[model samples]
Target chain A: MPPLPVITGLGFITSIGQDRATVGRSLRELQHGFERVEFFGNPNLPVKVAGTIKGFDFPTPSWRDWRWPDRFTVDRELLRGLAPHGVYALCALQQALTEAGLEPGELGDGTTGLFCASAGSPFMLGSFLGQMRETRGERGNPMGVVSSIAGTLNFNLATHYRITGAVCGFVSACASSSHALGYAMDEIRLGRQQRMLVVGAEDMTDESIMAFSSLRALSNNPDPATASRPFDRRRDGFVGTGGAVALIVEDAALARRRGAHIIAELIGWGQAGDGHSVTASHPEGAGLREAMRRSLADARVNARDVGYVNAHATSTVAGDRSEALALHATFTSQGARPRVSSTKALTGHGLSLAGVMEAAFCALAIDEGFIPGAAHLEEPDPVCTGLDLPRTSLAEAPGLVLNNSSGFGGSNVCHLLRRPA
Target chain B: MKTSAPSPTASTEHEQSIRHLPAPARAAFEQFQAGGDPATLDPVVLAILADFSPRASEIPLADLPGDTMLIDDLGFDSLAITEVVFAAEDLFRINITNEEIVQVRTLDHLRGFIRAKVAGRSAR
Candidate 1:
């Protein structure tokens, strides 16, 4: 059949770390990235903590001046109109392209495409609403209009890079980026595009935090480090967070021809809709099971051959339990149950960004031969107990890994990644 | 995340300029003036200039010559010029129509237009 798509470059920024090396190191050191909410701290709110990126200043004049080199000069002034998610996507894409040694408009004959996933522009909407209230909607920031669009990230990146090929945006909630990455793989496999950049970005605002708090879907634990304990008995819910991740994906032959450093082989991708709930996952995890099975089947790899499973366990009572049931049904029935864990335990739930970040984590794990432990995972619940939820880093790398990502709308996406030979 | 627009720091002289401004403009300008450099700068004017200038370009805002042309000297494009006007409107909480914006050429001209708007508002 067609050649497998490979990841040539990876760039990610999260509460855990900014780059792969640093994130891997942090994982090994058992350093959790969650911290007290910096934006909003309502003492009465049930959730008081999040996986916040401390002092995150992207495109900030002073921050960029010191951090970015002259060659990477960007017109920060022009970007002032973009939403935070848009900025995060552009920054992540820049890093990925730089690492891949590609410049804007240099993607070889425009066969390059872009796929972006975002949890809408909540931050900009909030700011715009406030501005509208203050200005009585008569006068507000002109940029407010651009930032309010959900496709801001996709449109901004495509225009900035001049990627004249297919540009698409996916809004599958938490599974959004996973769907983006999966579709990018499909395009390459279908010979529709030679290269694609998959991006996932999110901007968590006080409104989002309050929304989750209203739903009682956030962890009430005041401790940032241990608040997001996936699969643990004490787990309450995911800690809200925001960040971005980008992956430069290309046809395996094209990547090898370009002599790009192949990070991992994206072998399979599967997506399914549970059709069960608007906000909650299916208790039986029927959709998740189908997604995993489809992913393995698409990869043409046996379930027994899989080495690790990056679970979409958000630490909520129903979410984690449902994911565990899906995992047990998908991997356990087959011989050699793969080790399963959720990096969300450290990075928390970055909404639309969660999928791609966790997928990137799997790529890093394969590249470095280290599987990160599910941080703060103590006293695993009986329903999730059978799975090998290692609390410490696995020194040896697995040959293949499965990344499971699901969203509020019962959208589930699974990706199978393999170590590049 | 708001774009890191150059916030206008009202100087003592800038604050003095507010006295001549109308009540609405003075109130708006005072908010801009709060917690900024006390140097003799008309922050509103300086902010409008700085917003349109290139980030790395050496455009000295503190001591701008009154005769400097916005285009030839500062290299502001059409869009950049529009952004300056928008920023001004947002800061001063005043409505600057497109027709009025086109007539503004120099930094001094723009400053005069703002002063006129504030004075016009006070007359109401």
Candidate 2:
């Protein structure tokens, strides 16, 4: 309904790394984060590997107010201190404020809002389920009980930042953060707020692994090095990964006048729901096509203007094929196709964090002028022949990039990004 | 809270009795065995529930008391209670109501609720 706000600053933590430079270096070197299961229980399960964040340390009692920090310990512990979705949002907001040379108290209390996306039910529920199984017929510890809900984490973040504006969590599965980003952009553009912090975060849990494994939707490769081969013919399935990514979105005019280092412009965002089955995608990629087409139209850019696509290919059988079909349809309609790549091969599907991870990738790509290729893509699926998927390494400079995140419940979202002049 | 009249089916009764699970009471055992026997309650599920209400594991089967607080005594918070209810429903293949959950706080009360609902459902 309104023009999208510009992204002023960004912060992200993934299996790859915790900061932009570190993650970028890893991406350039084609380093991966997947590894064999070790710490978590039942390592002998069919899906025994994941992209786990190693040796992360969150701020402790000595660093921050113990009471304030304890409230978010549930998420912090889950992430090993990489910052939960809400903490990530706060860090990104702070970075943007600092870059814009604004003070922590500058925006006032009620003017700043927080919108975040996450597969809310999974992490907490899965943990609770696991606990329930372990202590059958036994009463649970109160501390563990309160810490496992989706809302608690969001509330903790809002409380910690003392944000008084609208604070809400979106649970549209994988589209969670994308939807949150879109909402925050609209809020700023429509004058709901001059600034908003949007974030996406997820915690990898054994239940998540089991669920994906049950659906046969994960790569079973034991070698963490080559596990997440997106778009590769031998790609088994997506490797589950976890992390948080945050972006500070603000009104472009305000940012310009303030001399903020505007990283990229959030030209447009489009979201569509297929009303399809809970887990299965529509055969023709109807919802995905509409989302992309609408995003492009909203950005007032032609198909040819799009230089790269960050695909939502989780390497699942149905998901990969369906996304490919959708891309083929979108590009073919305009008589040209953009080079496509899947960062999931690098970061694993961050679930709720996938969109933000890809968004960060887009921002970095635009700034650096090179698009990162989908790692481990040796052979392409015959059904995906129509798409121009990059395989070898980072190649062409990207002027504009599109990040796609299609989730369960048939929710599809697309964000279009353009390099800042 | 207003308690709904108990249903007449076996499954419905089981679903309705979740709220009355007392400290250390076994709420979802029968249901957990619905798809044949599971050999044991899933360890992960047990661990999560125990974390929610430690007394759930601390209370002995012989010492199960009717008046113990699910939250205060057994540690079943709002979220934990919700999970327990869902787990029972999944195990028993029955849909439960929030009202029913609200009324359950003791082991006997939960058993009665499930017994009534299961009987009511079977009558149909």
lDDT of 2: 0.68
Task: Kindly list the per-residue Cα lDDT of model 1 for residues A1-421, writing each as its tens digit.
Answer: 4867999888866778776677888877768787776445456666778776554543322112223223333465546556655656666777788878787768636799999988677656776778668545553555566656677788777777777888999998889999999999999999999999999988755754557777789888889878989989999888988878999999999888888899899999888889999999999898998998899889888889998999999889999998998888887766567888888888889888988998888998898888888778879999975788888888988779999999988999999999987
TM-score of each: 0.84, 0.69
Tell me the deviation in Å of residue A416 in model 2.
0.7
Regions more than 4 Å wrong, model 2? A1-4, A57-103, A121-146, B1-124
Using DockQ as the measure, the top candidate is 1
- Check candidate 1 and list the clashing pairs: none
TM-score of chain A of each: 0.93, 0.86
Q: What C-alpha lDDT, on a 0 to 100 scale, does residue B124 get in candidate 1?
A: 57
